[model samples]
Target chain A: MSSTAGSTLTHQETDLHLQGVINRPYQVVVWNDPVNLMSYVAWVFRSYFGHSKEKARELMLQVHHRGKAVVSSGAREKMERHVTAMHNYGLQATLEEAE
Target chain B: MARAFRATTRGYKADLESHERRLLSQLCADVITMLETRGKQLTGDDAPAGTDAEDDYAHFRRELAGLGDQIDGSDAAGGLAPPDDAALARLLPDASSDPQEAAQFRRLSESSLRESKLADLRAARMALEGEPVSLTEEQAPVFGRALNDVRLTLASRLGVEDEADAEQIHQMAKAGSAATTEALMAELYAFSTWLQETLFSAMLDVMPEDD
Candidate 1:
């Protein structure tokens, strides 16, 4: 489906397409928890994932209001690492094959 | 009286009274002990014989090597079960919804995760030992992590699984510092919540505006 953006692809993006076609991608999903403070969740998004202040707050709000949010998406191995990192930060995060 | 955390030019600062600091320190220690107990269960080591700093390093290396073997499937019990204790389970949660995948993930990474959390908790303990409970920029997240663990532990005990429970806890906390065990827990939980809110607010303020 991403085939329409072909010409603008960098060499790395082209390589990513090749890999993505071969391997299904995964998403890191962070779930809502009342115990984790809102500010702490937003700070984690900004600090750990390097999301912008706006992006972090948005994702944090999504997790808060929507009960869960996809914080990141990538190869399975990379997403697994992020899952572990989130656990270390005391966040309830899980990984699954992206639909 | 204790002051909430605030951002400083150097890093972050919170003025905690002696009792407050001591209470937080004890909470960190409690979580560390719980994790260490889980660590022992994961590695199947009852008591490490390491007596001193040097010996402990070697002991740690050996255990890590054992964990490496477990990950490689050399050990039959590599796929370990999650912690039965609810509080411990909350701190170290399942990484996948699928049971098999979660077990495999836990087998591969739980020990290291537990160790890293223990390290953070220990560092936070030292940070709390100071009069003002100051954290350098480098130590801010580390301290924040340890503080978060304490909050998680308290939350687990408080049964704060949903917003309703949290609201009930808020009301309980307002019932004075200690009328009952649950009330005491609620107060401590609320205090930790306020402390963490201030710390992360300061941290977020200092962050670069964009990714």
Candidate 2:
């Protein structure tokens, strides 16, 4: 039951193309750092991102084996917020335009 | 001997000796001082500011006066640069690979990040005040973060740039000699690594697997 209340043009397609220059999704990438513990990283991914234990472990491993991993992706502002949150958790994270 | 953090009926507990507690609390206070100094630096004052025993009006006046000048600047784009000190830089890293963008992002977010980290460290000091370090479920994560910050500071001083560097530090700690300051840092780093490992492992044990 989508709300269709306030349109002079009724029954219009709400799904317009938003993936242009302005709406390109941004991602928060967490980098592997020697100071942060593996267990701590997994916990941060779980509690902060609400990832399942397995999923969080998987992402933590990716950051461990690979140089980094994109833990989240969304609007630029949201990704920026996530990057700040990751920084607050003492994890090295950078915000980038999602490919 | 410091007992590893373990899940208990109430929340989480670690049995630390008095000296250990004192050491951790002092470290927390040191980090708090570092962050407060950093905050003042970010607000564009090299001299430590705003800890007067005067009246509230004086404080408010200082606040507006300090902020007023900064806001009046024409371009907010040229923001505060990251700290030159390796420990401070590691604690608050760049949010972007691009230098300009990273500076801008640091300008926008570093203050609040510093505040939150300081808050965690203060809470950790309070937690350390007890006979046995006990944490409520809510407090555990905050304590964990403060412990991690201490480790990060030690790691920076130990020059732990990569896995190889970390291995050297581990070996140094395993040698069990604090003859030099570097060896002492390694010992503290290893101790923090063990404590944090136990903490998160206990925490993860309680969290739902949902596999």
Worst 10 residues of 2 chain A by lDDT: A10-19
User: Cα RMSD for candidate 2?
Assistant: 7.1
Q: Number of clashing pairs, model 1?
A: 0
Please, what are the lDDT tens digits per residue for candidate 1 over residues B129-210?
Answer: 9989899999999998888999899888888889899989988888776878888888888898889889988888787677
Candidate 1 stretches greater than 4 Å from native: A1-21, B47-78
Residue B139 miss distance in model 2 (angstroms): 0.2
Per-residue lDDT tens digits for candidate 2, residues B6-61, read: 99988899999998899888988888988887776555455334543332343344
Clashes of each: 0, 0
Give the range of the ten consecutive residues with the poorest summed lDDT in model 1 chain A. A1-10
> How far out, in Å, is residue B65 in model 1?
30
lDDT of each: 0.84, 0.83
- Chain A TM-scores, one per candidate? 0.79, 0.81
lDDT of each residue in A1-99, candidate 1, tens digit only = 124354666656668657566467889999999888899998988888989888889999999999999999988888989999999999999988899
For each candidate in turn, the TM-score is 0.83, 0.85
Task: Report the C-alpha lDDT of model 2 over A35-90, residue by residue, as the tens digit.
Answer: 78899999999999999888898999999999899999988888889999998889
Give me the runs in candidate 2 sitting further than 4 Å from their true place: A1-19, B48-76
State in Å the error of residue A9, model 1.
25
